[model samples]
Target: MQDRNVYTIQQLSAFSGLTVRTLRHYDDLGLLPARERNSSGHRLYSRSDLLRLQQIMFYRELDVPLSEIAEIVDDPDFSLTEALERHRKRIGAEISRLQKLIATIDTTLHTVNQETMSDRTNEELLYDGFSKEQIEEINAEVDLTYDPAIVAESRKRAKVMTKKEIEAFKIESSDILNGLIAAFRRGAAADSEETLKWIGRHVDTINRFYTPTPEIISGLGDLYVQDPRFTEYYDKHVDGLAAYVRKGMKAYAESMRT
Candidate 1:
């Protein structure tokens, strides 16, 4: 055993599920600092480095854009104490939300266990996981942040569509999402030409449903930005997703002539 707190970069990478390349990039970006180097010049991690990785992951959870996070985390005045304090508050908020979700799920499961529950409405069976008011509030946030012309265009496409058409379109979207997820799972390079083809298909799906121009299709990247719901969808399916999708979409969109 080397020591109680000291770890090699490869060890830390395995412990944290981060790639060695990503840790190197973080080091290059100055987001994560190395603790020490052994005689052979291998980077080693200390308890401090582990804590720093935690801080970086927290910032990533909120999608703070790694470049900006690098600046904030690297400043001499930057205090891990401050970052941790902020994390505690944010985590407290999430705990409260998760508790509510748990209650809804528990209630639904209880109902599902009962023979008499067959008559319950689907909404009731779902246990009112979110109030209609909450959905309205979310929609309000999206409306406020989404570009108006793009929103109008997206909304117009929806307005012109029949319910059956929308359902059919959603099937296409689901297929595209599953494909993107599978590609990521297979460890495909996010910037590969084949990956860009998948991204172009994704854009086509959005254009079919949302009337997105290549630019607007790219702008819909904001969905992953401004909405935790969207973020959760990606995170549930793939790690490092939102960034990969964003990079791929931008590459694909810029190549498009129409």
Candidate 2:
């Protein structure tokens, strides 16, 4: 039978699969103090210490900051069972977020590939599942410059779409973005005939879906590079794709009589 009392740092590291350096750092951070030292002066962990480390790791999985987690796990009133329940619920939320994000990527890729869509507005297609406040913040950053009429219509259209329709649209967009990234990797020039064609399609789709005035699309093009959120959204689909899309949109919009 295994002993349940004292454990050398190595034994604790093995059991927890945590690096010795990490444990030492945690000790330095006062998240976990060495329970005792052996006769030769090496650090030793106790059953209590190991259990505490497990609690810390559990919080980390939920993206809780280390400092906050230390305070939480070390609190006498903090219930381990309650913590586990919270963790389970938080995990479910994270999974839901990931699922929505994947769908958004897919829809973006699809729209990029098709090169055409109606003027109902698909700009906020990726905004599903976000809290209302978060959605407002996102729109304020990117969609605020859009035509109010187009924005309202887009919102209405989004509300009417079935869940399956949204999911299908997301996957389609993801495919287009992945393809663009691949082409970009192969040295396709952003303004090259083929590449510009894809970018042009993207602009057209947004205009068609959002019914954004030419000026609205042009304004968005200008903001693409200046706004990190827009840049990151495009970049996530493909490296350096954001700047290229911005350029393409600018060129297409400039061609229009805004």
Best by TM-score: 1
RMSD of 1: 6.3
Question: What value does the lDDT take at residue 143 in candidate 2?
Answer: 53
List lDDT for all candidates, in order: 0.77, 0.73
Per-residue alpha-carbon lDDT of candidate 2 for residues 16-130, written as tens digits (9 for 90 to 100): 9887877898888899999778779988888879878988888765445578988898788988788778878988887988898888788878888986545557777756556
The residue-level lDDT of candidate 2 at 105 comes to: 82
lDDT of 1 by residue, 173-193 (tens): 888788778888778887787
What global local distance difference test value does model 1 have? 0.77
lDDT of 1 at 182: 80
| Model 1 regions lying over 4 Å from their true place | 1-4, 75-82, 108-137, 141-196, 207-258
TM-score of each: 0.61, 0.46
For each predicted model, how many residue pairs clash, with residues at least 3 apart or on different chains? 0, 21
Off by over 4 Å in 2: 1-6, 14-18, 60-67, 129-131, 135-258
